[model samples]
Target: MRNGFKIISFFIDPGAIQPFVQNAGFQSGLLQTIVDDRWSETNRDVYAFWPRLSTLYNLNNNQPSTWWLRNGSFLRLKQVDLGYTLPNLKKVAIKSSRLYFSATNLFVISKFKMWDVEMGGNGLGYPVQSIYSLGLQVNL
Candidate 1:
């Protein structure tokens, strides 16, 4: 908060999951949702991890080379508000009035890919939202 302005922020870790579980289903399972580019596929070599079934025996291999520790940490501006009270507005038949502008979930900075790193499961969850608003207050 500063000069009649205030701001609040929030974020979640969305702890990491098995290398391929978030987006890729079990190797034997028929359902797979490739939600992020970091997930491994059949032949794609780019930032890809082993498919779900392939890592069944090696679930503990969470090395830097693997995308498991993809830094779920995120920073969000969250909300901000600025207001100013007009000098005695008695002349206008008003005692006091203040104008303000605000915003919520303004922006985010994160290394995790997909909708939101905090969503955890390769972007399968609903994404955070951003909102803007303006308002005025008066006291007679």
Candidate 2:
């Protein structure tokens, strides 16, 4: 399992003076709901349990807590390779021939929706890349 250290920074941190431009984070939608329902009590059913944005902003002054912690465990299909070898061909003077296909970084299964668990902490580093390869080998 991966641990989240700076995950709260991705949301509304105490040092963040300017408004966030992107609203793609996990709490963005919930924050938006809080904003939209601030004036209407009827519209607060979705997040009635959550505190207002102002309250959360004030709470940000405190140190990070378990609230920001996330389960980053994941199951990934890291690599795969398949190959077939042909029988010896005396007529063609070929002792052995083989064909192979290989692939990497295929897929991941995880409850961590924010980012890849393998990336560690904030997951801001370069993303994992997918690669596919095919090859043929012949011995004559």
Candidate closest to the true structure, highest TM-score: 2
Worst 10 residues of 2 by lDDT: 4-13
Regions more than 4 Å wrong, model 2: 1-58
> Would you list the clashing residue pairs of candidate 1?
78-105
Candidate 1 at residue 109, lDDT? 76
Q: What is the C-alpha lDDT of each candidate?
A: 0.54, 0.52
Candidate 1 wrongly placed segments (more than 4 Å)? 1-21, 24-67
> Model 1 over residues 14-122: C-alpha lDDT tens digits?
3443323433233323234332323355446555543333435555333344444444566766667767666787887898887888787777776644355445554
Clashes of each: 1, 0
Candidate whose lDDT is highest? 1
